[model samples]
Target: MRPRSRHRVDELLRELATWEPKELRELQAALGGLQTALERESSKTARQPSPGHIEEKYIQRGNKRHGPYLYLRYWEAGKLRSKYLGKKPE
Candidate 1:
């Protein structure tokens, strides 16, 4: 990997070490859910769209517009979709 990519990987590893047990569990559950969804989609007889992709983003909500919370963005049926991941850590 390039130096920049290596540095980012190391930084992410360090950040992961700081996560609380609950946070880690949430991440694990999210990944497991993704896996299950993939498996279910594969078993369906109906033609499915090409495998979608995911990206991290921040989304805003509420009347006061009180966010920019972390989110997972992807494509489904050629439409963009997102799932909230919670607020960005300080």
Candidate 2:
């Protein structure tokens, strides 16, 4: 087969880039729909009163040489929990 033309390849690349914004909009809409569905499900399955409002406590750690670090502590269960949404501390 003959090689593809450079001009044709550039045109196709430009078209692909131009399609990105529309694709992103579609993705955002789908995500919003999914979020709404999840919230509806959560509301239907409630067994207890919603947890108290989540609070974020930012703290700094580490030394000057190693560089300081920022962390978040959530107040729950009468304690300061260092995890967010069950995710391990980074």
Candidate 3:
């Protein structure tokens, strides 16, 4: 959290300390539900896959054109790599 948000949370907790026991219990239950929802959202996004990009490559062959080959390009291990999808029919 940012420094400002942390300060706000700190101030809120101080205020909570002065609340009645029944109110504190209600706040605890509400916080538990909020925490569960946030965790579920976090995990859902963590499982989604990124499809970097699609690229095409072209080549010249014996006075004829051979290209527009397709590839899936992405970054891995701090390096850029490509996975061949397919090539145009000869």
Candidate 4:
């Protein structure tokens, strides 16, 4: 990665490092909720062949007015899907 990109990642890491215990717990709970929702949704639909793999990813959304927020990304049936996680607590 370029220096700028590395620096940006470092900055994000630093920001994450400053999160409070409560905030971390909130994020964890959100993740659990997401997992449950996925499971329920999948169960409601007919089973399909696995797309070889499934991945959970974090994505950053940039908005000039609202700053940035993180989202959860995943794949189902060879298609990409995402859900809004939450904004970093102030």
Candidate 5:
């Protein structure tokens, strides 16, 4: 089977960018497949964290409710470490 193209997945991100305040469920559904792909990529063991964990952090950063925090994943000592991810709102 052919791999899915990033362009196709990018549609969801675009949709999310303009996503309505009230259509979160629909937005999530649109992005769900992309989200899963990101998770899978992040989990590759060469020196990365699990995809699920990475997705969690990405979602955290994307959330307006979180406001002040930024999120990141990094490799160190053969482990995927999640730090403060982002700062708390003042």
Candidate 6:
């Protein structure tokens, strides 16, 4: 932590020692609620998608092009793989 933030936290903690048991319990409950909320939010953004490239592909048959589908090109286990997403525009 930065020096200023550390000083503020230390000062706040020192003041906590002077609080009564009832006040401390209330503080603990409030902090517990806040901690739960923060953890829940943290887990949500943590499940990120693997880094990859989105490509548009098509297949030619006779005299026609079949599709312009979306594919995710990602590397795994020392090999490249293409994951089909959908036939959507880029």
Prediction RMSDs, each to the true structure: 10.4, 16.4, 19.9, 13.3, 14.1, 18.8
TM-score of 4: 0.33
lDDT of 2 by residue, 17-65 (tens): 7677766555444444445445654677543333222233444456424
lDDT scores of the candidates, listed in order: 0.59, 0.45, 0.63, 0.56, 0.48, 0.64
TM-score of each: 0.36, 0.29, 0.44, 0.33, 0.23, 0.42
Total residue pair clashes for candidate 3: 0
* Residue-by-residue lDDT tens digits, candidate 5, 1-90: 545787776776787778676566543433443464456666654543233233232235454444455444444344444434455445
In model 4, how large is the Cα lDDT of residue 38?
A: 65
Q: Write the per-residue lDDT of candidate 1 for residues 1-24, one digit (tens) a residue.
A: 579989998998899899998877
Q: What TM value does model 1 have? A: 0.36
Q: Once superposed on the true structure, which residue ranges of model 4 sit more than 4 Å away at CA? A: 1-15, 45-90
Query: Which clashing pairs does model 4 show?
Result: none
User: What does candidate 6's lDDT look like per residue over 43-90, in tens digits?
Assistant: 665534443455679989999998898765655444555557688754
Worst 10 residues of 5 by lDDT: 49-58
> Which candidate has the highest TM-score of all?
3
Candidate 4 per-residue C-alpha lDDT over 1-90 given as tens digits, one digit per residue, 9 for 90 to 100: 579989997998798799998877555555554675567556775654332222334454574255245555544434545556567456
TM-score of 5: 0.23
Clashes per candidate, residues 3 or more apart or on different chains: 0, 0, 0, 0, 3, 0
Residue 46 error, candidate 2, Å? 12
- Candidate 3 residue-wise lDDT at 47: 39
| Model 5 ranges with Cα > 4 A deviation | 1-4, 27-90
Better of 5 and 6 by TM-score: 6
